[model samples]
Target: MSSIRGARVAALSAVVVAAFALSACSGGATDDPPASAEQTLRLSAQAPPSSWAIGNAPGGDATMYLSVYDTLLRTTPDAEITEGLAEEWEYNDDLTELTLHLREGQEFTDGEPVDADAVVASLNVSREGPSTATNLTAVSDVTATDESTVVLTLSQPDAALLPNLADVAGAIGAPDVLTAESSTLEPVGSGPYILDSSSVAGSNYVLKKNPDNWDADSFPFETVQFQIIADPTAITNAMQAGQLDWIALNTPDQLAQFPEPKYTSGSNNANGLGVLWLADREGTIVPALKDVRVRQAINLAIDRESIAEKLQVGSLHPTEQVVNPNGGAWSDELNETYSYNLEEAKALMAEAGYADGFAVTMPSTFLSTPYEPTFSQQLGDIGIQVTWETVPFQDFLTKVFSQNYGMYFMFNAFRSADSVDVRGATTAIFNPFNSTSPEYEALIAEANSSESADAFAPVNEYFVKEAWFAPIFYTAGPWVASDKVTYTPAKTFYPSLKPWAPAN
Candidate 1:
């Protein structure tokens, strides 16, 4: 795995709450004997998969299913795009239509032929299903023009379609299973492995290699097993005692226990720490937030470096803009746009007529509580008070888009500039009240249409200048593996079977 890259033109395997590793640390066992009997790759899942059905799959964390489903397209170990069930695929000049040429003689566990009709049926079922439907909204129709060809007619152009095909959205299921209500309990995919029935629902899940797999080498292990463990300390202890092969180093600051000789580590380019103020740019809920001066002042009040140190996950450098440094829209100069200046912050607040300070309601979940103290103490000094509303961890996302909050903080997923500029800024799930303006919409269109990723420069600058959101840092998540396990990150993806290998 030279690099994690297959860029719809990118890929999330999710991390732990209040954690994901910060840096990469390489290790070796040159002087020790290599373990040869452990061929079955063993690891832990952040949580168990709720359903085996691709359409009704889990959101963000698909660590257990990546090995069970072979999508229409394949993403190589290096994250490069390649052919899968559909041997060849092409898009029309305007990019409104896509054609997929299916491979002959492929079959699912249920003996269903992997043909054009099957692909169309599978995709159509996923289009209407939950969890996967959002990515396929632009697809107007799916039709098998012939026995070997499937065409997708879209109402509008989508730039993320390519790499997205390698994800759950591109997963092709047997037509019978797709139509069956029991599909969620029983998976009938043609990937490297099939879910073993011996497994329990939430405790442990196992996968046995698919005898008729098309790409067996991508997943070298004959047996892949996952244990649902939420505590990082427990995971480290398991790996230390040789009970596990791999786990997420969610608590990067506590890596002293996973010392070398037995363990090695790596990370993925994944996310950014930030607070989405939600819609209400006009300050309908919190009038002080409507003023540009107050928003900018809030940006200045943040001490990114301190937050990075306290969080102890991801990079040490605090981020300065919405777009990641790797994305085309990123500008190095923007990092300097909002440096810590409490005096200047006070001045801006005073200018906005908030010299006496202001209070606003904010939501707090287990996933976001780690940073609450920093915001409370830092912002309090600048005259802004925060009142927290406690919400259950499972209900946080539902509360975010539905309720009006002055701000909510979390590590935002950053696969590419397209995902942030398009999905985060324009979609109803993330932007319900249409927080963006016509001017920002034009910039988004430009960035999406441009041949180069750099077309996002204007958009990145605008995000920082407008101070609609406060970005603290960018991160490449951490993973610690046993000496016998070789790890390769799947670029935008979370840890999965494709990136873990038996060192032998």
Candidate 2:
């Protein structure tokens, strides 16, 4: 993984230097403009927008949501938070109240003022919306104290609140459009671009640059078109044929097709925490998983390093903890605690009175994983019968949240304004439905109350000790783009176009 990443960095640096030289020698010629000077950007996207409303859109489709609406706070590709719609924000000493000062002189696409009242309405809508409601669980009330100031009062001291607001929850909408039923179809926002009415739903979307937008100069492109292409092969074909300017490659095989010079590629540490959900820990649905020994055995059954090497295509870092490796809460000791030991795993299963093994069902979204067969084989060796079920990505979430399966595979990379916010990641996975341990809850409360990384270490340790989750890896992937454009990937699961610029 290190070698692959090093080569990508070296190649990207060369491409950037060449781009700068070409720009310097151009002499501001408008007649013989560079290929990138064709400002209309056509890109490929994996997830199509379900609705025009930012709050209703799936959280994973950030590329679409961010193109239509701007958040109160903007997160850079390097994971640094900067001002967006809001000029500044501060939390009270007790950490229960948060105040946001909106940037004056800004207006929504509908010519409405981007004031505190608009922000308050937008946030309240988000709080009731499906996409952001779970993240804003700690929020109690939102109020507009003044013309340009909005205050959010939380029921508890939530360390993840700011980060949650930085996501879809903080996207401010036009007051008039906020109550309209067609807001999901025809949206009004204060973002750099406005959704064009000519856009064809599901197939493609066109966004025209908003002339009144404050950050219009930074966007550069006059028009941006997003083409929905879920198939990897189709996306690669579109890029090769010059129909698409940018796309993300989930595997190294897809990335290898786009060579350097003609294409510039870069990678970011995936904010993702790949985990296995053993939902029936109490044996209400699956009797075998009730024993602690059985759960511990399940943890040691699979070889995560091998999975990363083969399935991840040198793009992931094998991990045992939920916190990202870049974050301060990550612990090397916890990562090494559950080393792969098939013999021990089998022994533990036998000790738990499962010598004859029990039948269990595992649900998956993808057709297969690099180590899926091996994972099942290992369990079979310990007398556990395995059954596999496949479902769509949307249905996958519904099943997990409804607790409809015994075990399932999932990944989460919840990002907030604070780059080191471990609480955001932990809370995203171990919510009320999934986690019921009182000791773990107490540790989480203590960690969330403190601003120090050392305080959160114990919570991560507790997650590992209790075998709450079997974390597989820290995933990362390449963002492949034509040399006509220079692109930087965001440090989040969902891709955003904010970091892309013309190569010239």
- The candidate that wins on lDDT is 1
Report the lDDT tens digits of candidate 1 across residue range 266-369.
55454433544545676766788778888899889999888877676443357776555555667787898889999999999999899989987788865557
lDDT of each: 0.65, 0.64
Q: What is residue 83's positional error in candidate 2, in angstroms?
A: 1.7
* Local accuracy of candidate 2 as per-residue lDDT tens digits, 432-501: 1454578877876776677774666787777678776677776565667788676654444223445556
Question: What TM-score does model 2 achieve against the real structure?
Answer: 0.86
Candidate 1: regions farther than 4 A off: 1-38, 76-79, 251-253, 267-277, 282-284, 313-316, 420-429
- Where model 2 places Cα greater than 4 Å from the true spot, the runs are 1-38, 253-256, 367-371, 392-394, 414-432, 453-455, 490-495
Model 2 CA lDDT for position 180: 84
Give per-model TM-scores: 0.86, 0.86
